[model samples]
Target: MNTKSLTLRWNKRHWVLLTSLLLVLCLVMPQWASAHAYVVKASPEENELLVTAPQRLTLEFNESLQTAFYNIKITDPDGNQADDGNVQIDPQRPHILETGLRSGLGDGTYTVSWKAVSADGHPISGAYVFHIGEPSGSPAGLKDLASGSGAAGGPLKWIVSFTDWIQYLGLSVMLGILAFLLLRIAPASLQREPMDVPGSYKLLWISYGAASFAALVSLPLNTLYESGVDLNQFSWALIGSALKLTSFGQIWMLQMLIALLIAVTLLSGYDLDRTIRVRIWSSYGTLLLVLGWLLTHAMTGHPAAAEQRVLAVTMNFVHLVAAAFWIGALTAMAVCLPLLTNRLPAKVRGEIYWVTLRRFMAWGMGAVAVLVATGIYGSLVILPAPVLTSLFTTAYGLVLIGKIALLVVMLVFAGYHTKRAKAATGERLSRSLKAELAAGAIILALAAILTHLSPGQPASAGPYQGTETTEDGSVITLQVSPNVTGENQFEVSIKRADGSVVKDLEQVTLSLTHLDMDMGIYEITIPKNETGIYKADDYISMPGNWSIKVHALTRSLDALDAEFSIKAAKP
Candidate 1:
């Protein structure tokens, strides 16, 4: 082929490669980005030891946290209030909050209850038991805390972390590549003859389009994990519920816009009517993409949102758009720099790449600045002073630190890429830029892992401790002892039809069924102590007839359950 034909051919090849990458990225990013929010660590670590009573408790989340209608409750061993006051967002940490524990908790078992809206606006709540002093009576058995006994398993946690990492890395790669294509190749392609704008447009749209599909798949996976459903028998309702959440809804809407943009861009390639409308739609679609990013994460408390939702939402939009532009521009530079060198005259291509690199560097730097400023402001709005130390000590705090570290690495790569692009010696420059891009991808993957880990449980009394046992292979035995007042404790021993002690059984679970209240049934595991015996310690807060159901699983996995009556009288 002649020199002119050869140049055109190379351009076509570049376009094809760019389009393929976009398509792959879109298909993969959402799965990585849409990880479920979790608590990785908390203040007053599980089974913690405090030399003295703490003035306040803090809970940290892995990602930015939402503060609307957050609730936390602390009750002493005897069911007396331990919470000093209402729960409030702390002023120092972006993803955590602190609340006062009611004073004078007189050394006893305490139950901390918590409920909060995650960054995505999902409400999550649970309870943990902690003691101010030495625990009384025998502790509950480990079998009771195992899987099938209602306790989360280690494997499940690993799955959550793995999926989270996948989504994070995927999103970074997808965004980075798209940015590279738009800022670098698109402009050049437009300037060339017989502009393949339609093809380039398809690449861009498909990248986002694939992202939506990936998100859809991820939602179902998340639902299954959360519900602990068998993969083969996963319920569609769970998937439907996941889609209804704000994050999924925003992404779905963005996908629609992407679809429309692709249609308009393709039609614009032809001598189409309503050209103005097409342009308007295209611009609106871009704006929606920005909005999608903003709204998707807005449920997480924004620095301004703690004070007012309107301003927070607005700032969040700006932040997301800026990020997209920065990442997209960097990706474009990486892909185009080499191709441009091969296509245009050496000096002309070099100058073009340098000028583009300089502008993007400035823009990316500005984006980073805004991200940091807003991030700090947001943290202060939610986290209080007392629990600040939890940020580093807890799981959630560590993840946040990891994310910050990754951002720093990205900045370093950006700096190096800019410097080398400006001072490249032909072939060596292209390879170096590619390596930098690869490094950015790795950073994103780490972010994905961070998202999957739970931030930390709400600062509470700590973990429940007590013992349970079943006797004579037919009788169930339980003993209750608490450190706090106003909390009800129940101890019940039930005799089954068979004379054998229930202790010979393989597993034991206890449930409290209440009447006239929606307290919901609670299931607890009973552990075996010295000689063939099963024992448990559980709380029942009010004086009432509580049907205690003892379910014993034999070694054969056969379950035998017995019910007994119990009453709690005010002390």
Candidate 2:
């Protein structure tokens, strides 16, 4: 065979080896990912509880849970559910679920059941029972706490957010480097005398091949972890299950495509076949890297709303391709720039670098435009006002803000470097570009941190207001109270439409519901000493919105029923 044919054969062999290695690596990483700490015990102890009623139920897990998804449920002997609205994670101790019990239960067995997904995406579920005597006659026809369900509160959300940031930053940097090489450095490397070292290109192909595998495997595993699936069960079967049910399918497919492209490129290079086949595969590999960005970032973005999901997917595809072209070019430049500066005539290398830089800048600008447009739309859709506030107020929010700040800093640095590189003479220009690369690394680190912070609920207020009324009469009244207080207290007075005091009502029963958790009935027994004014020493445990159901009963007959809501601002 001619030397040319021998080169082609060698490239083919190289491609096969890299592809196989990547495939194996993708299969093995999930085990390590799944081995993290999980929920091991609960105070109510998963379907087991004492006959004696306790004021609070405790949950103990093998690992400290992320505070995002903590909650619990209480079921009466009759199966009526009293949901305690919001279950908060105590700040002083991060693992504890802290909240207060509802009123009304009088002497009977009750069951407390719970299901939570941890910060790392593991689902923890169990039940326990306690007794509440004099059980307010099971509050006719109340909604069962079991009827309501939601994702668990904990750190998994922040983990997903942080991982996303890392994936994007890493992808951007890698692509930028590749783009630099293709547009600026590759031609320079080719023009020079070919190095005699055997399998030199193998190092690049292997590293990228490994990255492609990690990207593919990690994307799906991350998705599964977020969805509350058991990571320990990872296998071909599980992978197939996730592909069928999750948004991860698209990510997996993209990874596979990139892996294939990598294999083909390696093969072409090893075969010493610098024919159109090699160029085609290399270009395809680059294209796959670019497209991978959409599968990873764009679909989850803000602009993804009005446009159909398919359209979002398409736009993300374009966005990723553009980013890869930009970043990949940067990678290529970093590798070839030093060599070009050292070996070639200074004037000739400088001209080449300038032309390449201009090309990369155009592509980078396009990627930025896509990122901005899509990002804005995504924020509007996914981030609503209250969640955004959470992003800033909560731990997750602070990190995200920091990440954005760093990204802005990176862009500014890039602009400065671009200007300096254009005007500088000799080594000064090279130094400036190198400094810009270092700055990019810092930005990537910030991106990683941002991913760890919670996307949090956007900031909003006034979703609730306070009001009061007599259950039987046609009197409506608004009460003004202090904005902040440690003790939960509210003043109330009622009058008829004619401004006469509502003296006919004998008693008012207050049933408070926290979020969905029912805090039974608190009967406001009016003492003869207090006249028409009724008061109780009972106080709520925390500050927030509490739905009050007021029932007016006269003698044995049902007089009337009325509903009023109030917001308890933090004191």
Candidate 3:
């Protein structure tokens, strides 16, 4: 009954199983597993004044959306819901969602509030205001900063993040312990009688239980998140909607199933000297299941939403596998310090401890090599141009910095532990392991927090610029000086392919509008400077997406106009 003895065995059949699972993960990703969907186009566009109320409210997104738990509500100036309860996606055009508006909607300003689950299962919600009659003094939005389409907020965000940390900690520990037992410790002791490390095994079960709880709770939590329902408002409908409508819900559901399979496989194993490794194998099924489990983490992670899917997901999987082995093995070693027990003589135990530490570290160092390399590459990919600016200016960057710092400290502790292993006492080794694990726990916390954040932190301290070419080879360059959300100047330059400036423009007006919510447009007329530059001063009310429409006229009766969007970062 101990170590859940099922007495079966396995072998190199695992290699084939592992390869097949890799192919499945690499070749097949969820069709709609992409970025969070936001409003790309809106009927009666943001801040548009209508002489008469529209018959229906429609919104379009860059990504396809699901119908379950999706809503489109129009709130009148008095803040009353104005749209009919039925919101549905257009059958022909999967990206568009529409709902009928009640007749005779009163004037003033009406806000369209929307909520939807992206195919990947992430919840996104936002609101925009459009006036029914005359232009209201200003667009009615930007009041709730968190309302911008993105991750969960309030207690839910923290709850989900904390759960993510537990899930990671549990899985990594279990994986590391299994690798240590079957691959390292068991082989080394093959000449001796089959031995058991109860301390390590017990730790394994504890991790298993923790991971299971996280997997079980993940569904309900994701339901609440994607459905935008509070705990008190919990319902079966929320869970159903999440499972059927969002990729996130389904992805986690699959992971939970795999976890249950692992539990069953782990409980049964043969433990003779010849069959020790085979005990955990189960005809290669266990290895396949473990890898499939890790693959799910990558599938639902930020990498799944990346533009470079294969590279990002592959890099992420390798990083996850390496980290699981490294951190997990270290955790297992911390629990099973052979020198600390009286089962063996002090001199003999010391030598065993040294050997175990050295062997584990040799593999751990290789894991660390991949971890550090991928970690750096991922950081660069997530935080694009002006990387340093994004790192210091946003919450995501701040957390990443802390995680890296903790990792550095953990590495220092590991290096010192290795250096002193030959002459170390039991108590010293225990202290060193505890320190490293402590830092590791903090690192996981940061990593968990990061999952709930968007890595596209628009760089704040630069002249944001974009260039577009016209059919006739004319180029238009738009620039924003100090792209942070505050007072700033914008510049527009028109040039031909031959590098000559188009100085004959009669008039140029910039229509700046906030895309996340309704804001009064910044219609600025850029009078040319005596020095021959077109620029004007303006202010961005908040951090989000914005649109800049260029309206210009040529002195010779020709017209040149272009529209583009830019992201403004938080100040």
Give each model's clash number: 75, 89, 4
Local accuracy of candidate 1 as per-residue lDDT tens digits, 1-571: 4323443354357545644554454334211112223344556543344556677877665455444435667766565678877688665675675688766567655566565545544344444455567643222331121111011323554554454344333334344444443334333532442222223344444554554455445555555544444668767665565556434444545645654553454345333354655544543444344345434444342222234556555554554455445555555566544554456576566566555565555446556656555444433333323236545543445656665676676677776765654463344345555665565555545444433443332222222233333443544555544412124344434445465443445656777654422344555666544344565544443322346676767666766655665433222
Overall lDDT per candidate, in order of appearance? 0.48, 0.46, 0.69
Pull out the clashing pairs in model 3: 6-269, 120-248, 121-247, 121-248
Using all chains and alpha carbons, the TM-scores for the candidates as numbered come to: 0.49, 0.52, 0.72
RMSD of 1: 17.1
Instruction: Tally clashes: model 1.
Output: 75
Candidate 2 residues 163-206, lDDT tens each?
55445555554455444444433344434322212223543555
Off by over 4 Å in 3: 1-35, 91-94, 103-106, 136-146, 185-187, 190-195, 270-280, 283-287, 339-342, 421-428, 457-542, 545-571
**Candidates 1 and 3 compared by TM-score, better number:** 3
Sorted by lDDT (best first), the order is 3, 1, 2
Which candidate's lDDT is highest?
Answer: 3
- Given candidate 1, what's the lDDT at residue 351? 60
Better of 2 and 3 by TM-score: 3
